[model samples]
Target: MSEKDTTNTSIEENVITLQTAQEWAARWRENPLNTVKAHLIPRVDINELLAEKYVVDIRAYIGVDDQGVNKLMLVGVDAAGNDLINASNGDYIYDFTQPCPNTCDVDSPLYTLKP
Candidate 1:
């Protein structure tokens, strides 16, 4: 895929903001998986595809929509939080893996805060 297409697939926005705990709670109510635990991988073995070359970290947050499509945004943050990448449908599998796809680069526009 073209670089543009790859970016389009990874970038997303969180409708909820981190103003207060109440707001955070409201956001979570909309999407239960918005909690940190939801983004975490209990067993690294499940991530066999990552091998040793790639390091995975989890981050989570709540997302809200006017239409009531609240979502839990679980993202995989690299060693550096700036290098955030969205997990693939709660699954980390990729069609192919390399040093890191251009989409995975820290400077890619696809990078964003978990929530």
Candidate 2:
């Protein structure tokens, strides 16, 4: 098999979607370390729920770290409970030791209550 085919195998194994990839890219830009922490929660099952609920299959959940760095890792299993592989671009992986050039664009909550 060619390199492209090899790469595709990993991608297929790690069934990530475009929207999920974009979210990960955004998170990487916002906070690198926090992104890592978010991935640490074992109960947050991305593969199971996404496969059961959404039409699109999710192989991995991408996010940023506290240092405002982008990164992607295999954190969940497939619908068949197979281990995921890294299918993202190599150059896109952000260094978590550096400061984020841009702030997170997550929308603020519209409501606020005074205690």
Candidate 3:
């Protein structure tokens, strides 16, 4: 498929209220095994990914880092369901999240379980 083809390239905004966001986070944290509260990725990296050629969307996958820590790996996708990544070269794919347990914002409600 060509980049000009808008087949599956329609942008859909996934907007959610803060209350819902908090509730979802809280629910995820309810599971004892889900120790990693959140993952932080730089806006610049996301911007770069979105700016890539034929990158109509981004897909995130759950992964584990070299240290056995859970991580999020992101890759750009085209309208034809093709991944915009190179396994051994380039920098489009990303796994640079900072997991919450060690780098969480103490003031954020999403980082804690409500009593």
Q: Which candidate number has the best lDDT?
A: 3
Off by over 4 Å in 2: 1-11, 32-62, 65-70, 73-115
Best by TM-score: 3
The CA lDDT at 53 in model 3 is 73
Residue 69 of model 2 has an lDDT of 51
**Backbone clash count for every predicted candidate, in the order shown:** 0, 11, 0
- What TM-score does model 1 achieve against the real structure? 0.28
TM-score of 2: 0.23
What are the lDDT figures for the candidates, one per model?
0.35, 0.37, 0.58
lDDT of 2: 0.37
Error of 1 at 113 (Å): 30
By the TM-score metric, which is better: model 2 or model 3?
Answer: 3
Q: Is candidate 2 or candidate 3 better by lDDT?
A: 3
Listed in order, each prediction's TM-score against the native is 0.28, 0.23, 0.60
- Model 3 spans > 4 angstroms off: 1-34, 87-91
Q: Taking the tens digit of each residue's C-alpha lDDT, what string does model 3 give over 1-115?
A: 1122223332222222334334444554444476777877666667767886788898865545435565666778989988776534332556555677776787787766654
Which window of 10 residues has the lowest lDDT sum in candidate 1?
93-102
